[model samples]
Target: MTGMKAFFGTFIKEIKLLTRDPAGLILLFLMPSAFIISLSLALEGTFMTVEKSVNKYKIAVVNNNTGHDGKNIIDLFEKSGKLIVLTNFEKTLLSEERARRAIIDSDIIAAVIIPQLDKNRDRRAEIKLIIDPGLANEVGSFLQYSLQQYIYISEIARLNIEKNMLQKSIYPQTVEYKANLGTIASNSGDFSIKKYYALREATTDIIPTSVQQNVPGWTIFALFWIAQILGINILGEITDGSFRRVKVSPTSERIWLTGKIVPYFLINLLQVLFLFALGVYLMPKIGLPALEIHNTGALVILTLAVSLCAISLGVLFAALSRSSFMLSSFSAMILLLMSVLGGIMVPKFVMPPVMQDFSMWVPHGWAIDGYMNVLVKQSGIRDILPAVYRLLIFSLLFFSAGYLALKSKLGRI
Candidate 1:
């Protein structure tokens, strides 16, 4: 149809305009690529949390007793098989000072200090438990309980041996131990855990999310910026009466509108592919972990959806602005604010609940989440379908706004 000719004509005009603007293309491609690489490298180190699991934790035991009881308690801890037990420091017996240093240095989670137990219950030596403040509360409690159960067992074994030797001894039946607070003092000394890093038990298994956020975050940022340029271009054409001329031409308005979006949509896709490729292949060469993709097919589809959203946002930008300066300033301000809330500048996992919900409310949030699901999480197409749907909805809303503007003289300018 002649309508198709109008569409192709507009599409080609957009392309020729793009080709004439080499500086703009460089700003689009070169600037963002450099920024993505640098920021990704910059964020390689940040708040990293280790998961709390038995095999992953290490503990130390300091036995000053020199008696079989201390050895027996060590045996109990080792037998539990919940964590690794280190009884010696540098091939020698572990000292209290050394054990404390180890806990501070993050070599071990906690240290159990068993003092010499007196034969008389009234004059018994107290055991001490010192822990890293960063340790999970449950880990501290678990260690304290383990110390209690087996320390008593050691005493009972000693009493049986003494009874076998004399055959006519009656000891008190009750077990009484005093607990104090502060530094790991005597066994009867206070059981207090010191604060080290105050780490949380909950953690993700992948690379630091701050770093994971950079590639996708900045890429989405770059893609959305296309809206600013796209909006400004539309405003210029409108002010110059280019679109007015098109309205009077034989071209169908619908086809002409679609043509306007496709060029920038293709540009957005290329930007995404270029940025993501650097994240995957070039990052590891610079000493960071390579970005991993969970599903390639899903990634391709999601990229298209994100590109569509960016193009839609461009249309909305053009619809709202009456001048080039207005379009530029408005799009930049709104895009950056959205970036902050969308987990582009800050990863969502680290954000508080209210901000996280706000981030999800924005279209940029959905686009980044979809990229993360594909890049970081082990997500299938089915898992990402909701994000894709959300992006489609955002596109629809933006296009509707642009359509309404076009019906008025503002978009025709």
Candidate 2:
């Protein structure tokens, strides 16, 4: 009978509608879990976190050195325990071609070839790295840098040994490390990506593994997928002229929009919490490290901002798209594109510099970055405020735009 009563009735109806949608429930719950497990396993050897030292990224090594230098280099990688060296697979020693193929086949992260050293040079063997092009850039760089550090340290030790034997030697500048990445086309693509994902990873005290990135990153992605569901629902109501019927009532537009938003907003929060639960509890059951959060407050506020942003964006889309086909197709395309660019399918560290800059423009990137700060970086409430602020700004803008869009659409502007 009253506006408040009408708003509550509409909210309760919307909540019922959301809960009954089997398709939406499956997409929000089942699909993300599948992606988390599949992707984490696929990239397992490519991404290793500092917290878990027992497991290492797998790399094949081929030693061609005439003397013990090659053996010593292999020893270094093995001793580090961060890289699992596979000198032989199936009882045969790894050759350069076999190693390269191994990387191409996605069996290993990289292939290391230790060339024979020049006896007169008194230097260590030239270590060549053959990386997988499909490998995340941050991942490729981590392996490259790790190998270089090991060889660099070994060289320093070798130089010291020589200096004592000869009683004197000048330390020449260390040779720059070069990595040759195999590409999809030639299978020998020289990956020359200049920017390292390490720049971002270095800010966090703990290195993020594939699982850590997925728990939060994919959760943000599935959260945004809510936009499509909300947009479609609103579009359905509009097509049936249900909105015009409601608009004739005494209830204000705020009540109408709020009714549409609150139900889906709550659903989105549950989606995030559910995914995070899997990360913390179910992930370890599969042998992956359990997702740990440093600040629950940061996560809670961030989730609130993120869900608000997504629902508002959905409202904006539903208002703008006049037809079912237009709403569904465009919103799905846009969400998928944003997900790829937003570090959902790939980590921000995996993307190049220009794309990373572009990611800042979207709320998905902000949400993903915020969640990563909380989960991986062990960042506190203060640390995630900027991200929370950005997401809130996005929600404000989207809601304003959607309001204007709806007003114009009803009046044929």
**For candidate 2, which ten residues in a row score worst on lDDT?**
182-191
Q: How much lDDT does each candidate structure score?
A: 0.71, 0.72
Stretches of candidate 1 off by over 4 Å are 47-211, 410-413
lDDT tens digits, residues 66-86, model 2? Answer: 555556657767887677889
RMSD of 1: 14.8
TM-score of each: 0.63, 0.63
By summed lDDT, the worst window of 10 consecutive residues in model 1 runs over 196-205
- Residue range 223-298, candidate 1, lDDT tens digits: 8899888878876887887777877788766787788789999898889788888878988798766677758899
Best by lDDT: 2
Clashing pairs in 2: 183-189
